[model samples]
Target: MNDALLALTPTLELPSVAREQALKKQTNISDYDFLLGWLYPEDELLPPNLALFSKTTGPVFIDFLGGKKNHRRQFGGGKGQPLARAVGIASDFTPKVIDATAGMGGDAFVFATLGCEVLMIERSPIVAALLQDALNRAHLELQLEAEGKTYRFDDDEHSFLTATISRMQLVNADAADYLNHTKPEADAIYLDPMYPEKKKKAATNKEMTALQGLVGPDIDSSKLLEAAMTVAKKRVAVKRPAKAEPIQLESGKKPSASIQSPNTRYDLYVVASTQS
Candidate 1:
């Protein structure tokens, strides 16, 4: 957990099912300082959400059902988005993607919304738990909608969100280790290893600030990139700050191509062959 001050708080008076699941997650995390607790909504209709109660950053949780994520899922440029293009998404093809450093799952959800099957790998157990909780809640909402019950979104939007959520899968593991052991099946590998915080830019969002504090930087990103290149069947996409230099591989190799957006760049390494 990168030596972050984190701990599981006592489960609140949640619905029976949600309480059980929260307890399981609490048991899974071995070390932490403060608390892992639920933030109950004032609206009785809204469900209680699992959150990491950080003294420095307040509560941090992943919410795919609403908020910025849902808004992006609805309006974020479809396949035309830079992230989609970087992963080789086209009208004729939608690549299965493995997100090697799936911090907070923002990018993974975007890929899923674009109709790509996305495997999100997060090394931090705390982040992984939050992601899993969000996925579970999203799936439950989808199931309720299918049963002709109350849903958070309208019918059309419900259908779209359901499909998007269904396409995403999460795993808590070291990216390099997972990629090295798994078969080279995914068409693209996406790496968004954390970069050092820039001094000149405005402070990052609380979610990102908390994440950086917990996971720290990916010092071994170059090695992870190498492993991803070996495992990815078609290409490996490394997301970098627009002005930042590309990751330096131990093999002295460089990205085959680069795709740029206003604030970010995707360094593409087209895979030539797979290692045995």
Candidate 2:
């Protein structure tokens, strides 16, 4: 592993349950020798038993069952949001989405809640571990909700939450490799590669900052776009900063259309064969 990636996990300690889950995931933490183990106090406010803490950059973890994810699902726009528009969601047609870069699983969660079957691929083992933990917990919570055990949400929210879990599948792999070798059929492929921030100081979000620190920029996003174009049956959606230019594929073609919001722009590459 590179020194920068190693720096992302200065301390990688797992709680007992997280260790058990890691074993089931076939991921051995011992292989990452550079990560030291630092025990947290039992009363610490962390939700997931495991977390990746960087002294310089705060800890990062996933919590789909509660906290930010729950809040977003409850109040966030369902199918009317810009991302939904970018992916081409409609009242009569809900396209299957392959979220090639499933960072933290936010977009996938939204798509799933909107009745789209979403296949999420996360390449980083560390990020995948966090996502898997959240997915497992979310599934359990959905089961409880189905049995009328949890009352934190109403019937509509509960139903959508259940659908999100049932429709989502997380896979740990590179998006390019998955699209190339697996040939998994999907109506659309969504790419949210980390583009260069327009303003260095304007990027204040902790999660995104830590993510960029770990993964760096997606320098080969154009190549990924090429792979996505070949695989997507309907279209490919690339999320970009508002000012960034649309991705240019190997054929020197840009997105056919683009939808813009205040903070981001979604560039859509509609396949000629699958246009509606």
Q: Residue by residue across 147-167, what tens digits does model 2's lDDT show?
A: 866556688777767777888
Rate residue 190 of model 2 by lDDT: 98
Residues 1-276, candidate 1, lDDT per residue (tens digit)? Answer: 211112332122111123333445543333433246666665554556767644356667888878888788778988998999999999999999999899888999999988999999999877887888789878876787678666567888888888889999999899898888876479999999898776797878878988887778889998899898888888999999998998987788888899999999999999877322
The Cα local distance difference test for each model comes to 0.79, 0.74
Clashing residue pairs in candidate 1, if any? 6-32, 6-33, 8-36, 9-36
Quote the lDDT for 195 in model 1.
Answer: 84
Estimate the TM-score for candidate 2: 0.80
Off by over 4 Å in 2: 1-47, 144-151, 154-156, 197-199
Q: What is every candidate's alpha-carbon RMSD to the true fold?
A: 6.6, 7.1
